[model samples]
Target: MPRRAEPPARRATVRDVAARAGVSPGTVSKALNGTGQISRATRDRILAAAQEIDFRPNALARSVFERRSYTVGLITTDSFERFSVPVMLGAEDALGAGKISVFMCDSRDDPIREKHYVDVLLGRRVDGFIVTGRIFNEREPLDVSPGVPVVYALTPSSDPGDCSIVVDDAAAGRVAGEHLIRLGRRRIGHITGSAWFDPARRRAAGLAEALGAAGLEVAGDPLYGDWTEAWGRQATHILLRSCPEVDAIYCGSDILARGVGDSLRELGRRVPEDVALIGTDNWEFIAGGARPPLTSVDLGLSTVGRLAARRLLEAIGGNSRAGKEYVPCHLVVRGSTDDLPPASTGSAS
Candidate 1:
């Protein structure tokens, strides 16, 4: 064969793909990333051209061109908290797998820290924000940085349509309430975590529905407090004083259940016998270390994290059916609620 000249080097770009496909550069990107409101035939043509031209994405150049960091900002309270850690880890792993870098900020349960972190992340021009669970009321400082998609985990701001990944809190509470009732306990008390949090509110609502369905009222008003051992211990006393006849108590969290167990035993009560108990946030390894493991609702923390990250990646890749996503929860029964007769111990219990 006769000697031939080498092909000239040309930087691969959306423009080149557009030219080859007889379309616009905007159309080319939309097709490649599967985004933008475009016709299916046109998208197909652009994709075919991109493949033919061997277009490789230079993420660094793309970031510079778009004036973005291509990084996702994850803001959470209490990073060291056992439940939060698993969720954060799942999000990080999923994001990393999608070639996305994570920039994390811990609020440590302080609104000031939370606002500061939001400001910093906004300044960094992150592509998206994953707001983890924090107790922010309407009066709290709001972060309204435009042009970046925001995804929330565990909680969302008061505004509607904010994309979020959360477990159905009310459903979880209903599960707890139903379980106690099914166990033949007529008088059920409640030990709730922070009332300021929205999830706590939903849980209370769920508990009410469950009890209402069984034609039984809650033993008394729920003992409201934080999700701490101290509060759990304190609330147990209040619950007992308010409803001495209560035969079961649905705690807001496993930590609270642990405290309740301590209090019950101190008062000469036997778990699942004198007073059966149920809790949420099956933080089993840490909170359910008691002799008889605490029965709880598995809120699917890791699942929430993974789903949030996956949804974020999908958005970045141009899939835009974005809104709130909820992961369902199930009950994990242990010794705490085992007093139910063998015949009544259904699959859920």
Candidate 2:
């Protein structure tokens, strides 16, 4: 009453692939491992054979032979929030293309936790590391063995010798100021976060620089406060009270801009028609959700992550670069600054 079951098919092996490709096993190994000198034709033939037989190489065995785990450790202090997420995604995109796996760890701003993650990832023999966080301030270098490669993204390492990828904060402000200037807005007010933060100061300086180049000056000194909608609202009233002729306002963040916009509406000032608003970070959700979508500076967070990953890859390959590399910021046009419809997602030139 029982029926016989079919036998399981045998798995494909390197020898089978080599035989099918009419090449020696050694040649197949060379081709698959990307070692030694092999002609393109032979490599292609071996690859084709491996594909035809549905062959999958043993990752562990391959790693052993290559003496590399082909894995990277990504450590973040931002808890994968809005700032770090894009950077992480960009790093993943780059690492994935190299067939490298990533191990994500969150330090949550604790030194002990960061050290523990570093030790564990080192134990796993990850080929390299990418460190990222919310702020652009330089952080202490990651503690690791001498030979291990590490690239800092967004948040730079304090050591001048380490490679760091960062957004150009000054450029963000300069670009915003230039845009407002081009719109014939001579009286532009600056509203932003704390004065102690390096980025906030740099952005304020940049806005001043842009205004200066046009033989003009900001309507008033930059209103420095904590980064919040409430600050934005309060600062707006103050700025208007002192310089009611301010035709434009540039905020350090989209959240601040939203609050500023709300305040402007309450004060019976029409957006664009009366006072154009621009913000930083170009965070789509906050910028897009504003009554009139907010035009903001895109800090190229993803690009920072991608470049950091590339730099790490280079370091792993024995070609490392030191010092800081700044990715440029770009403007994203939106309803608040321009009369045109909302632009598509992501940063624009």
Candidate 3:
């Protein structure tokens, strides 16, 4: 048998894979790194060719994906407030699953502090960033150099081109309205946060749209105020006074729902039996603590963080996406709207 020829001294390069696979080096890289969109057949052919050459992807080659810092900076202007906590937790969970570390920074809604944290994170060489804020409004994009990927969560970037992940507030409101409508409640009322808040207005609009689609309207215009239990109580009084026949009420937040639930009791209305109540942000504590338990909309905050982390990973891998992405919202039913409350003290609570 003839002796086997010795291999070349230099290791095979991406060019070698491209030539063998009959594709370009860029396509070869994308296929190997799972970056760009390539047909499965081509990708498989490229991978096979790469393996046939005994090609080894070294750190330098991997660096094509920005050096695999495998780290992300999660900056929030809400100081880890209740609204932002679950998002952070979900993001951390996802990034951790991918063996990526996260550096959390609270900008406290201060532009100067946010800039400082951005600079520090950049110095630390984070591969990408996920900027979050309490309000569901468009905000100024982070001051970062081009090609350094950044994703906005909850709070989107004013630059519409930037990628943003946010809760589907409209969907939440629509779901709540549909749920109430399905229960045959035509005289519905709404109590929410300040109209100045984008979420407040969006939720109110969604509720109105859903009600309108059903050929009905809210018993009265949505009462807008701050997101406080006190506001909930006061708004409840006004909603009741204006719409005495109101059968169901939708609140913008769980806190507000809690207040409304208490005021409903004081006004001698039995939940679901006499009137139904629903709110947003299935915050377990407030929802569970509320009398008769609160039915609320789970805005999928964790889903927002997880999706943001996933998007950042793709961005770091050179498959960056743009525009706003809305995470779906869910309903958490409890005695507040259910005819019979759950017997166990679990998620239903």
**TM-score per candidate, chains pooled:** 0.73, 0.94, 0.79
| Candidate 1 global CA lDDT score | 0.78
CA shift at 7, candidate 3, in angstroms? 38
Decreasing lDDT order of the candidates: 2, 3, 1
**lDDT by residue for model 2 over 1-349, one digit each (tens)?**
7989989999898999999999998999999879889999999999999999999988898889878999999999997488989999999999998889999999999999999999999999999899999877889999999999999998999999999998899999999999998888888999999988889999999999999999999988899998899999999999988888788899999989988998988887878777899999989999989878899999999999899999999999999999999999999998888753222221111
- Please report how far candidate 3 places residue 177 from its true position, in Å: 0.8
Report the poorest 10 consecutive residues by lDDT, candidate 1.
Answer: 340-349
lDDT of 3: 0.86
Judged by lDDT against the true structure, how good is candidate 2?
A: 0.91
Superior candidate under TM-score, 1 versus 3:
3
Off by over 4 Å in 3: 1-66, 340-349
> lDDT per residue, candidate 3, 1-349, as tens digits?
9999998799888999999999999999899778899999999999999999998876544645656667789989886488678888989888887667889899998989999999998987788899998977899889987789999889999888889998888998899999998887888899999898999998998999999999998888899998999999888888888777778899999999888888877787778777789999999999988878889999999999989988988888789889999999999999888754312111110
How would you order the candidates by TM-score, starting with the best? 2, 3, 1
Q: How would you encode candidate 1's per-residue C-alpha lDDT over 1-349 as one tens digit per residue?
A: 9889998988788889989999888777777666689898898888788889898878887788766677988887755656557678889888877577888888887878888887888787777877775442322224747556767777654555566777888899899999988888988888888787777788888999999998988888977888887888888788787777778889888888888888887776778787898888888684468758888899888888888888776666666444566799999989889966422211110
